[model samples]
Target: MKSLVFRVFAVFTLVLVAAVSGCGQKGPVLNVYNWGDYIDESVLHDFEKKYNIRVNYDTFATNEDMYVKIKAGGSTYDVLFPSDYMIKRMIDEDMLEKLDFNNIPNYKYINDSFKNLEYDPNNEYSVPYMWGTVGILYNKKMVQEKPDSWGILWDKRYAKQILMMDSQRDSIGITLKYLGYSMNTKNPKELEEAKQALIKQKPLVLAYVVDEVKDKMIAGEAALAVVWSGDAIYCMRENPDLDYVIPKEGSNLWFDAMVIPKGTKRKKEAELFINYMCETDVAFRNTDYIGYSSPHTEAVKKLPAEIRNSRTAYPTEEDMANCEIFAHLGSMLKEFDRIWTEIKSN
Candidate 1:
């Protein structure tokens, strides 16, 4: 009897020890992939310290690069920051996981206008990170009058003094908008028109670039350029003469969202991170650090009056209504790429 009792006690002790050891061990970590210099680094560090989980971050210059890498299964990333159109494509490819909203309590702080967007109509798969427009940013000192039209980029006066984003989407989309066609237009005729317009303007530009446009524009290397609102904001800080404007014709309205990638083992942690970013205070911190607009309504309310009222950040209702949010163009993207390559090579 005593031997049987000893055996039972020994087995129970081993089971308890195994369970406790498992409980103490950490789970798989999070891998975050995002745009370069798009977020505040401190927020990431604080998240790591608070959660006791390691976060590995990576960056891509363009969404196409990110899509290609992710689709190739080159790396396993727990989270990705993608713009609206890319999110649509990712969803169609089943690359993103459906978010567990209950875990993201701070989501309620997001502006209602930002929710139910065409890309994530139900908001089941992504959370808004930053929202802005693609517009003209110019050095006022070089131009006697502010540029309110896309044609300013093609003006003979600004020749060799213009910089344009190297991105296929922004460059093509803006030309399409300038031509009075939908940025998401798949119409061959409209696309051809946009292509011709770009070719005409190509000789006038200093260079097609993404990063350092702010610095170049501020240093007076370029007098006018098409730039993202966030980048425009950065330029304004260095040179007060810098001005951002949504062309009277229109511009692309872009929203980048944080999403959990499929196959992530840290779903709970990923959800927590999203919620943490959505919190009013945290959202404000990110906007302050990144100099972009926050989509959280409560956070927007707390921003400085000058920032909250900046027409460039939050355009008037009429201007907002005129702007079209980019939609996934499917196969039309290939056509754009071919033309873009030809344009750049020439």
Candidate 2:
């Protein structure tokens, strides 16, 4: 998710009534790792100013990249922002610490609908942050016909004008969905089919990009792109010519959440930071600034009606019925990696 927020009409009524209290004494730097360009940088500035606890904020481009760095035993990250399936994988591997919900009192503001997700069924190790769907973002001027199916991505006319995600999980997962297979398919044959499908479509794709896809789409540089809904919102505001859709074939409904690592020495401080992030104003700032869907009930209520009701950001339940939350792949992830490498190289 990235920023260039909505018109949001004029000013919203969201307010933070009380100033946060400073940590009594200086503590070790709170090492936080999150997705690149996914948050409002000013939030970190404010959190720092409030707590007097220095934050060493860093970012990763993908979940796999972050997992590898954290799993290798050299890096010391205290808090991580990982998507649903990756969070499950980290928990299974014992890489995450069980969150002490008592410290996250603001958790009460989180929507019940977003709670108890399969990836964190018990809600023990992770806290929901931003959620969104994967869909097609296209320039309305360039695409005259309805871009309602993933199959359009393969249409010959759109060749050299389509952007696919650079991430292995997303690009491969959508291809699996397009082929009537589970995105978490552990079946070798099903995965092979998705792999072949992507290889065939490679010639049609203009580029494999992540965040850059947003800028390119906003500038009307591409006819279509596989993008996160949050990015689609940002692009739509910048270029009304841009629009988004969850294809008829269905797609991934994803959640990115916060979790502390297993070996953090500053656990309580990390909890404080997490609670602070969930505060109404902070949550609203992050959601508005980044254009992502916040799980915080109060924060969402504070959003302008346009954003609150935007079909792109919040699809109807019936439309969402076919969508799936990604599941931890375990050993099958290696197969996904192999398929992705071949797709990119082929």
Candidate 3:
């Protein structure tokens, strides 16, 4: 009887030890949501190795798609990459958590110019990741005249050879600029005019595209396409005949920033991840891989001379004097959506 009791006790102790060891081997997890093809994902692996924490990375094609998923709220995300205007909307809706910058010392590397922007005025909720101007990407061989203004998108000469962004904000914003209205204008008259302009131009547009813009432009599928600066840089690399220009009338100056959402269960871990991303070496790797404008001042210095000097990648103040950053539209978003549906249907 004593021997049987001893064997039972020994087996129970061993089972308890094994369970504890298994628990110890498991690490914390962080969920990151970002735009498609926006990051050098190798950084995620390096982060996991360095911290012994697993990263669950996900991507969305647009800000709206990300917003919809996050708003639906079944899953939890520690970190998110949202553009300036969307950041404002999220903040207004109380969807983001205030970041404790004390853990993010590497934020010192961010350019002062990129800080204290309209979207996150106090720098409490977000960190600027990448920024650039929206512009027209055109094929030099196909475009006989120099494409300098947004007016060219309306020209009949390029009809059926033009590609527009599928995004409502981008398509409408540029049309607003072409009509001499603010990109962030809330006036119904201005918005209607912009909508009508798009409806009229739809017949000329070859297609409305998103990520496919890079592939299409590279293959010479379209003569002219509205493109983000980073995609323009990537396309220019693949096709020498490609050139990017911010219309003379001006364009949207956009920024994508990292933020912690309200549902984050691991605030400290998220802060650590943001700090790691702000590290100079990591920022350099991302900029080199993604071809977007880095807000990290130190990382910009590490880029090649041509990229550092490229007007398409880094536009000068004179180039951006008339440009404006997008602002949150609040209830007006519904109006924009309604118009967009009309444009697409027509």
Candidate 4:
């Protein structure tokens, strides 16, 4: 009888241990990849607390960097933030999953104008996060003359005082615009002209940079720089001597949006996170922190009058009439990359 009792006690102990281990299992985790310094991190903490889930956040400096990682498929990401042209390229390649609006009701707060855009016409794949234009940021004290044209980037007087974006598309596209060619030009001759223009201007550039443009410009390290409107806003706030202007020759009008990749295993959790980001208070926090143009109508109304009225932050339709949105280049992307390499090498 004592031997029988020992066997039953051992079985009960084993069952209890298994039950305790099962209870300790963690909740669902969502992985998010976005541009560096793009969001308010407290938002991520709040999301975790509200949903009882874990968030693994990561950042990339450029769309190309993000693309290479996702394409390599070594890791899984639940969400991504990519700009307009990259979104179109991903959609064309069937690399993204269609978002279910049923899970994203807060999407209604997004302005109608930001919807049905060329990148995601049906609004099935992505949600607009921020929109802005590319332009020149210059130091008023350093530049004796006002800069109103892209030609100023190539001036010999400013040699070693000019900072250009290291991005392949922005660098090449702006050079094409400066040369009176379409930014999306697939013509070999126009591309060659752009390559030559960049090669000619290379001698004048201080350094090719990305986010570093903000600190360098604010510290008075460079006289002029090619920058996004959002960065211009932040830099101007930090240093009153800085100013931004869209060149008379025209520039690229761009949008960056949040998307779900095809590999995400937690679609429901991913959609929940996206919906949370679209909430009015969350949207306001993100826009207020990043200083980017918000697509949320209610959030825009909540911004300070100065920001709402500022021409640099919210450009008028007339101001943007000459601007163009970048289209997916398909196979032409290879040619652009090749040209960018040659220009960099020279």
Candidate 5:
């Protein structure tokens, strides 16, 4: 028995040493870019330990920023986490690699509903990471009445106490919805209305922010804020006085998914990391820490019952019936950019 154990250990040591020495080369390093504060991060170290690959992780604040960097053409990133519309744009531009699903067998664990999404109808270029809705996250103690409409944000009573998203798509898209238009509308007239509405409300807005919305809302610095459902969950947990509501008018339903860039030499290594991320245990750790909704069926089963069943985390179809998924705006996007600049400058 002692001889057998010693022999097995010797063989393992020889194979491990040969893996790095045989090629006179070091292990691969994969560059991954994703949203800030979006992952558990510890999982990256875990993946490194398990696969003998080093990860170089960086973060971007918004999808547009990410798109600009990658579009400028020097990024060495192997993996990315971009929202739906951006993914569609990347696919159309031939910026992404067609994923070989065979390398990511764990793809089967993702919920069927999250598959064949509008952006990747054939599931060709991306894997669903986290999904959620956009809504009003407000402090119950600061408001005289519950906020159920986006119109409430313009109330003079809440002037200088309302936080709005800094992102062009979310702020303007929500306004478009509030004005009884589609969040993805390309009509210049509708966009003008949305722009004017935002300009009108700008004086009431305390600030246009992103991640700071969570900290501000938690500290009671603002009475109300526009936030993603995941951020709302995190804020609500820290300060129970906070509550989130999907407006009666409508809102955008959005998600960020993982994809590989077309030029990556580390394609296999990238796929390995993606597969590792989808492992039930790894997926559970990410969602649990990030306060985001996981599309992994097995990981969803592992979440705490309270969060797993919370309507905020997983809204029923009726609640989301009116929600629109943003599509790639193409030239119409320039109109949005112009409007966003005007609103901010005003």
Candidate 6:
């Protein structure tokens, strides 16, 4: 009788400890993974406090890195922000979960131009986050006159003072665009022409970088560099003389979107978060923090006049007509990657 009583008492103590531990624990938790420095920290803190949910934020350097980790399986990422091309690739691989729109009531505020994109047609998979173009961020005083052509990147006077993107895809794609070929072109001759152009310009470059364009440009390390729109905005703020312009030879119009990863346990919570982010004010806050253009029309209207009117932030419609977004090229990616490695190796 004594042994039985002790066993029963021990089991009851264990059960009580488990129940107390569960109650003392925090509220719902959401894991959000995104690009580094991509969004405002205050916004995240505010979201967490408002919903009483713990948000475990994480970041990745590139889309490829993000894709590899998610593909490993059983990773718990409720939301992911990736470029259009990556989103298309993920969807093709069935790696993304379908979004439930009912929870995302603010979806209607998105601009029509950014909606129903080719990658997520019918609006089933993702929500557009930010959209802008790749262009030249230059120092106006050094150049004297604004460059209107891609050829300016190879100007002899700028030799050893020019900077270029370190990204293989973006660098090669821009070169192809400058040469009047499709960024996704598979033509061996066209690609070779672009390769030659890159080599000719390589000697002129100070450095090839992805994340340091703002710092280097601010410090006047390079007179000019190929930069994404968001980085250009931040760079302009870093130096009063700096300016951003889309080249006459055309440029890449890139778009990023938020999508739920496959097998996310908190599907409803994920949708709610997406909807919250899509709100006009919330989108504006994100753009202001990251220095990017907001694809949400309502959000754009809410921006300060200086930001909305700035040419670097909101290019005229005519400028936009000259840009193109990258598309998934299936088998050609390996070839592009091969050429990219060759360029870096040499």
Say which candidate scores most in lDDT: 3
Quick one: RMSD of model 4? Answer: 5.9
Score every model by TM-score: 0.88, 0.88, 0.90, 0.88, 0.89, 0.90
lDDT of 1 by residue, 159-217 (tens): 89999999888898888888788888888898888888888998999999878897798
What are the lDDT figures for the candidates, one per model?
0.87, 0.89, 0.93, 0.92, 0.92, 0.86
In candidate 5, stretches whose alpha carbon ends up further than 4 angstroms from where it belongs are: 1-24
* Runs of candidate 3 exceeding 4 Å displacement: 1-25
Residue-level error in angstroms, candidate 5, position 187: 0.5
RMSD of each: 7.8, 12.0, 5.7, 5.9, 9.4, 4.6
Where's the lowest-lDDT run of ten residues in candidate 5?
20-29
Off by over 4 Å in 1: 1-28
Ranked by TM-score, the better of candidates 1 and 6 is 6
**Per model, how many backbone clashes are there?**
0, 0, 0, 0, 0, 0
- Residue-wise C-alpha lDDT for candidate 6, range 1-346, written one tens digit per residue: 9999999999999999999767637777788999898898888888887788778799998888999899987678999999999998999999899887888889888888888877888889999888888999999888878889888888999998899998877899889988898887889999988888888888888999888888989988888899998888888877888998998778888888999998888888888888889877789899888888888889899888998998778888788776777887788888887887777777
**Deviation (Å) of 48 in candidate 5:** 1.6
Candidate 5 C-alpha lDDT tens digits along 1-346: 9999999999999999998566545688899999999999999999989999988899998898999999998888999999999999999999999998999999999999999989999999999999999999989999989888899999999999999999999999999999999999988899999999999999999999987898899999999999999989988999999998899888899889999998999999999889999999999999999889999999999989999888889888877878988999999878889999999898
The regions of model 2 sitting more than 4 angstroms off are: 1-25
Candidate 4 wrong stretches, greater than 4 Å: 1-24
Ranking by TM-score: 6, 3, 5, 1, 4, 2
* Pairs of residues clashing in candidate 2: none
Query: Model 4 over residues 1-346: C-alpha lDDT tens digits?
Result: 9989999999999999999766646888889999999999999999999999889899998898999999999889999999999999999999999999999999999999889898888989999999999999999999999898899999999999999999888999998998888888889999999998899999999999997999999999999999999999999999999988888888999999989999789899999998999999999999999999999999999999999988788888877766778998988989988988998888
